[model samples]
Target: MARTPSAMKYHRQSEKRRLDNRARKSTIRTFTKKALAAADSGDVDAAAKYQKVVQGLVDRAAKGSTLHKNTAARRKARLAKRINAAKASQGSA
Candidate 1:
């Protein structure tokens, strides 16, 4: 439905960006799960490591405009809180 060449090009670019952003979000979710799993299993070290990785990824995604800055910050905060709670509840946070 894009009649103009410029419009067609813009559509292609948007489609590509959509796929890339989707993949980026999926990766963030995967790492988040890993971090949560590590925390639930009481592995403080692994949880912290994965948390760091997720934070970096989220930051990058936000910087690249794939995620909003506030959303990224909120996610990082919630994940850290969950990890901390999991560790503390394990008796040696």
Candidate 2:
């Protein structure tokens, strides 16, 4: 319900940005899930590779404002920890 021309334009821009942000966030989540699945399956090498990809995606999302910087860092840390733990368990067994 934007009455003014500028307001209407702004609304359109915002809608586009919203869709783009949602897509980026979805992609980040998918990468994170893939990394975790690899870790859970005890494929340390594959998990590490996926974790690197996830880290890059998260960093890009944070830089672009799709995700908070701290949130991205925290997620990266958690993923790395999980990967390390998987590696440790694999080594011990």
Candidate 3:
């Protein structure tokens, strides 16, 4: 229901940005899940690798304003904790 020309253009731009943000968020979730699965499976190396990728994605999302800074930091911290725990268990095993 964008009556004015400028408003119509703004709506289009907003839609594009919305789709892009959604895609980025989905990618973040996919990597996060992969990292968590690797950690749960006790693959320290793979978990660490995936965690690194997820961290980068999260940082990028936060920078782009797709995710809040604190949210990104919290996620990274949790991922690191899981990886560390997996590493400790691996060493003990």
Using all chains and alpha carbons, the TM-scores for the candidates as numbered come to 0.94, 0.96, 0.94
Writing each residue's lDDT as its tens digit, candidate 1 over 8-89 gives 9999999999999999999999999999999999998999999999999999999998999999999999999999898889
- Candidate 2 lDDT, tens digit per residue, 18-53? 999999999988988999999999888989999999
Question: Candidate 3's C-alpha lDDT?
Answer: 0.92
Candidate 1 clashes: the total is 0
- RMSD after CA superposition, every candidate: 1.3, 0.7, 0.9
Report lDDT per candidate: 0.96, 0.93, 0.92
After superposition, the stretches of candidate 3 with alpha carbons farther than 4 Å from their true spots are none
Q: Is candidate 1 or candidate 2 better by TM-score?
A: 2
- The lowest-lDDT stretch of 10 consecutive residues in candidate 2 is 57-66
Report the lDDT of model 1 for residue 91: 80
**Separate clash counts for every candidate:** 0, 0, 0
Q: Is candidate 1 or candidate 3 better by lDDT?
A: 1
